[model samples]
Target: MSESARTHTRQRDDASGATTPAVPGTASFDRLGLPDGILRVLREQGVTVPFPIQAAALPHALAGRDVLGRGRTGSGKTLAFGLGMLARTAGRRAQPKEPLTLVLVPTRELAQQVGEALTPYAEALRLRLATVVGGVSVGRQAAVLRDGAEVVVATPGRLHDLVERRSCRLGRVRIVVLDEADQMCDMGFLPQVTEILDQVRPDGQRMLFSATLDHDVDQLVRDYLRDPAVHSVDPSSGAVSAVDHHVLVVHGPDRYAVTTEIAARDGRVVLFLDTKHGVDQLTRHLRAAGVAAAALHSGKSQPQRTRTLAQFKEGQVTALVATNVAARGLHVDDLDLVVNVDPATDPKDYLHRAGRTARAGRSGTVVTLVLSGQRRETSQVLADAGVTPKVAKVRSGEAELTRITGAKAPSGNPLDGGPVAPRPKNHNAPFRGLGSTKAAQGGSAGRPSRRTTEARKLAEAQRAARVRRGG
Candidate 1:
């Protein structure tokens, strides 16, 4: 191992005077031998210092060695793998339908996010990038691949579909990244992931990063990786010290009302439910109770999901109700609260759900609502996950709720007179130099302008033509 590859550890003395491994420290990215261009981009992003995971993984990865990385969410794993891939493949040109690098994530949201995070750096490196995922126009994604993207960020299933359609070819891939490998397995996409990996060049360097490694992930590593360098920054079962965990025991009848009270609190909050039906139902309930909220799940179309997440991030919507699809690899900035409307059944699920908050050294709180029947199971789950939360028995209108979660009574009024309407399907029309006809005619009624109607029709016609072209 190189001096930079050595894990920097300090000894922590306990009450018995015995030492334990302390959290490791990381050297700067420049010290890891990244190119000046990549370093310049990091500096522009205000990322002068490297996170522990990045420091540990970057050295091996930049050297074209296979790496197995383990780090908790918000540990900067994205940049750890992303920067290495970009730097290694710098100045490489991709052939049509054959990418030079591939990043496989588990969800469409993650694919989009990974793309967004890497785009600026890729631009700085003068590399072309594309994102491929389901729940959107596959033809559009195929067109991007056909135009030749040097790097492709994708989910396994959608990439498989494109490959089958002859829109993508992996023969020239030089480096591959399997981010959130454990979550991909949990979502039952390992088979598709395996199939996709089978197509990549045998000499391509592989990097696999996950919070936990079970039998399935182990199998993938054994089958594909060659003498990988393994680096783990944090324990898989451990909780973030910055997060304050709490279990609120509510009566079954009062759960919905109490949840509404919590959602109405100030600031952006994420509420997790066990099922998509529950997510949609709670979103409606929260909106009805006068909280601006949105739902994110597989049931939502890609456009709808993208819009909802954008609204939440931009503070146009303050609450997001979602299922496990949002549990891993979804990075929201300064989000301080996460509510588990339904307690997670698995220990890893609990950790990932709570991982949404208390990220990047920020203080945050995670509250799990446990009903009477779920108390025992919830306790076991927490214990197994190495979390010892403060258990409280609470109900609606209690001062404890306000003290813990900043819960406040909602002003039972619609948000801007109910939900915001979807944007017009046609967004490419040339702007007319005239004001709305309603305002021009001295009518105060809120209605679509004639120009708006025309734009929509034109957009719809264009969409129909594209569909006919299979693009």
Candidate 2:
């Protein structure tokens, strides 16, 4: 059968044609016109059944129609678009700077991950895929386009840069997929997304998938999608129902200690902090406690972010300290624990952060640290998200914290109820652009604030001490 006919048949048979099913296995990939070579690669990768998002959206996506898929993290949206890319781009004619398909994501990590997910399927069709995101040389990406890439997975900013430089063009692009649309909106990339979409061929197929259909997401659908099919899956709580939720009320001082215990787990631990500085400090503390860890935020270069994720995925780093940038598009399977170092302000964020672990029907724990002052906000989040967390006073360095979070034992609390390690004042380190010329001028503009200077000095001192110890 033709791809569009097959997809139409599958959609007609689906009870979730209009509404997304809250469960998986409603529609098989084969029914969605997934080519044999793609199926073979999927089998080799051990991805047999489709997730709910995939089951609901694949048919429409494969049928050459715009689709808006609403599903949470770990709901298998990546494969949904991957299948679409493979089906649409296979046997298509294309040239350098003219890709048949494009996938835009919020972060570099997600760009790489989406690229990885689509690579095998594309390869099965004798197609090449290129990943273009920030933190890497634009010349390299321009060269990749010059060399010819069938599909491109990229972040909006980097892709925009390439377009502005006339290194690539999407005039002939047949398909465009935006993964984690809400997160892209949350990161203030909606304008960029719109710009990129505008540059694409107006008649091209488009699919936008996200966890919640917020105002920002709604805007994209109205602006970019044409007669789009909307499919939402089991939206009772969040995208992931497999996660167990917990809210621990701890003293402000003990928060760091509690965070460290959770970070020192045997399996993969994703800890979400509120700020870049906090993540950097937490990463240092966790590493000093002998836990293999890395940090993901805008502070790190694109290459650094990529390497950190690779290490975490390969088990070289068991714990990953991050901000919200890693909360949405990051798909690390079998993550044992997710610690919300800071309370979530929005109901959607609560759901997305907790969804990091407990993916693919696997049991995982979601522990949110609630300071006394944050009780009100925390309670509001749980109520809005329809989750009742186990609330109790827990010490960071205690076994109860580990038991609640499913984290393993640590030899000792690295902080010992002491001060959290400070970030360093290195000329090489990146700053958050705090309206201060000191950062821009490197040490010449002026001295940083007392608090800032102290933190920087502490970081430098720690590094010096580490060097002295031959670490």
Candidate 3:
């Protein structure tokens, strides 16, 4: 960002607000019609101010008006709708197997993240919150629902499954939230989403919030939301001003070398690839080359995915190589870089990947390591995304690569599958079993290279991931 542009950009903690074009003055939670308890909680959390989207939509939402909110990821969309639900449903009680408020997200990761984000306030308001998602113990989730939860955060598929089993009911659901609606559509969950929405109380309040508002998402707005007060804090754009975008064109042979260098950069970074197979492949290579890298994709068990993210946030893992699962809902304070080892297949994917950084008013960089073969198509995708990135033709061990990404040579001692050298910070990152990048190169217990065995296991588990698209 230039000096002139820097003056116009405002950053908000993604846990609070997202980076956005500057708006005049700041907005406070107390002035946004939040209940006294929520306001007190916000202040206690040091969040006296609300993000632009939150400031704009909370009034209508609290007034029982349907809301159609539009904002990029991390722009405080969670709290914008969350506070209203928590406030409006404050004094309500839910019967066994029936929830009063429902939040439907696209993926299991997102569902879990939202539930975690809202848990504190829900507790403050005496609401029991249940997170329903796939890949976990459905029996436990059913038990929670059977015991009754005032709020349920879920993915469309699992929630639908629960409904089919008669373990849960939607009749009592008075407030419905379709968060990341566009993603639900993109992931082909529209049919299931609409089915679930149909089962909810007909005249209940509805809110649809997303980064983009086209395609199947529009269908949802037309069919479900009634007379919504639409608020768009940031227009859908590929080139967000807060992030410095770059495309480093590299030779095919040096692609991995360049990527390894960037992952070995001084700070923590999220590296994106399009496929689970590719993510695992690169993760193995990075670990073998001595960088503390971890793989996050549908290939791993849900527990593995959860543990890996916790480690990454706590700095036990320096490099996270993932598919779109980590693209949204994953938040790390002060993460200044996101790398596209493989360019996104579309414009929306690009924006979501870029959103991982430049958060909370902090300036971040998104770097794409492009091969010669992919340059043209990648250019078209970026153009569609409205990003005119700084294009650089570079190689490994070069000054320009170092300048752009702070790339450095790997230690080459191979991580040996043990934990990375910890870089713990002040934040309260969760404690987990903490394991990623496999054991030392030699086989343990008849398993050839532990990293190799893990990689094979991942590849085997994900052989059909590209086709099935598991949550």
CA lDDT of each candidate? 0.82, 0.75, 0.81
* lDDT-better candidate, 1 vs 2: 1
Between candidates 1 and 3, name the one with more favorable lDDT: 1
lDDT of 2 by residue, 1-471 (tens): 223112221121123345332222345666656889988988898877787667767777777878877766676778877787678788875698888788988888788888887888888898889999988899999999988998899999999899999999988887999888888898889888888888889988988877777787878877787767667666636455667788898765455556666776667888887889878877766776667778899989877888888898889988898898887667786786888877788888888888778776677888888878788889998889988877888864467876787554454434334553432222313222212234455665455678998999999999999999999
Instruction: Name model 2 segments beyond 4 Å from true.
Output: 1-26, 396-399, 407-409, 412-471
How does candidate 3 fare on TM-score? Answer: 0.83
Q: What is the lDDT of candidate 1?
A: 0.82
lDDT assessment of candidate 3: 0.81
Give per-candidate clash totals. Answer: 0, 1, 5
Clashes of 2: 1
Candidate 1 local lDDT, 105-193, one digit each (tens): 99999899999999988998899999999998999999999999999999999999999999999989989999999889888998998
How many angstroms is residue 390 displaced in model 3 relative to the true structure, after the best TM-score fit? 0.2
Q: What is the lDDT of candidate 2?
A: 0.75
What stretches of model 1 exceed 4 Å from their correct place? 1-26, 416-471
Tens digit per residue, CA lDDT, model 3, 266-371: 8899999878877887777678778899999988888898999999999999999999999888888889999998788799899999988987567899998787
